[model samples]
Target: MKGFTSYAIKNLKSTGSIARSSKFLARNLAKQVPTDAKTIVELGAGDGIITRELLKYMPQQAHLTSYEISEELLALLQRIDHPRFSLKHSSAMDIVQDFAIDSVDCLVSCLPLALFPLEMKHELLTHIRSVLKPNGLFLQYQYWLSDKQLIKEYFPHLKTNWVPLNLPPSFVYTGTAPNSELVAE
Candidate 1:
C-alpha cells in the first residue's frame, strides 16, 4: 500500500489509481454487499485495501476470492490470512474457468473498466453476469460515470453513488444482475 502511487504509475493500464482507496470509498462499496452473501469476488484487487475493507463488513461465513493480475499486488494480497479469504493470480476474464456459473452472491470490482477497450469491457461484464446468481450484486468504482450506459447492457438495475472522500473522488456503481445467463463473446 505504501508504494501505491509508484505501482499505479508504472501499471496505469491495470492498477488505474495513484492512491490506495480511502476508508470512505471502501466503506461505501462494502455497505452494498448483502449481509447474507456466501460467496464474494473482488476484481483487480490492487494493494488489497478494498479487499481488507470487504472482509471487515462481510458476514463471517462469506468467502472472498480476490483476483489480481499483478504479481507484486498478489504478493501483497497474500499477506491476508483469513480462512474465508483467497487470492487468484489471474485476470478477471478467466473468472468462469475458476468459479462455477451462477455461484457467486456478490462481486466488487476495481478493474478500471474505463481504461479498457469496449469489447474487453463487454467480456468482463459478461463474465461477471455469468458467475453471479439472479439479482446478484455487482459493485464497481470509477473516477467517472463513463461506463454506466455500457454496464446497463449487462445489469439492468444499476445505481451510482458518489464518494468525494477519495483522492480525485470516485463514483461507485451498484448493479443487480438480470435473471438470464451470459455467455462469453
Candidate 2:
C-alpha cells in the first residue's frame, strides 16, 4: 500500500488528537463530497492530504475553499497553486461568520469530531447547517463510530457508510438538508 513518508506520518502520529487519514480514507472521504458542488468548503485540511484528492475529482468549475489551523499545512497547500483552490489559514469557528448564511453548496471535513468538546461540536454543526444551501451536503469522516448519534441529532437525513480499506478503518457520514426552500427560508 502506498503510504505517507515516515517523517510525514510521524508528524501526524505525534499530533495525538488529530488523525492523519490514510490515502484510502482520504480518497473515500473525497468521494463523499459532491463532485458537482459549486462552492465547497473543507475544514481541517491537514497537510492538504484530502485537499489533493478533492481536487482530483472536483468539477473544473468548482471553487474549493479549505480551512486549516496549521500554518505549516497551509504553506504546503499554497504550493499546489490551483486556480480553483483557496487555502485559508484559520480555524473553522473563526470563519463561519465570513460567508453569508445559506450560501455554501457543500461542506466537507476531516476534523477529529471526537476530540472536540460536546458543546463546540454541536455549535459547529449548527453553524455549518446555517450556511449550507438547502440542498447542501455535509460530508465528514471519523476514525470511530461513537460520533454517529451526535451527527444524527443535527442532521436528521444522515446517511453513513464504512470504508475498511483504510488503515484502522473509517466511517463516512453524509448529511443532506431535506429541502432547498426550507433550508434557505
lDDT (CA) per prediction: 0.88, 0.76
Stretches of candidate 1 exceeding 4 Å from the true structure: 181-185
Task: Give the total clashing residue pairs for model 1.
Answer: 0
Output candidate 1 Cα RMSD.
1.7
TM per candidate: 0.95, 0.85
Best by TM-score: 1
Writing each residue's lDDT as its tens digit, candidate 2 over 1-185 gives: 12234434566542323345678877877776676688888998876778988888787778889988766666667877788998888889755676788888888977778777898888888778877888789898876888888887767788888888766688899998655333221
* TM-score (C-alpha, index-matched) for candidate 1: 0.95
TM-score of 2: 0.85
Q: What is the C-alpha RMSD of each candidate to the true structure, in Å?
A: 1.7, 4.0
Clash count (model 2, backbone only): 0
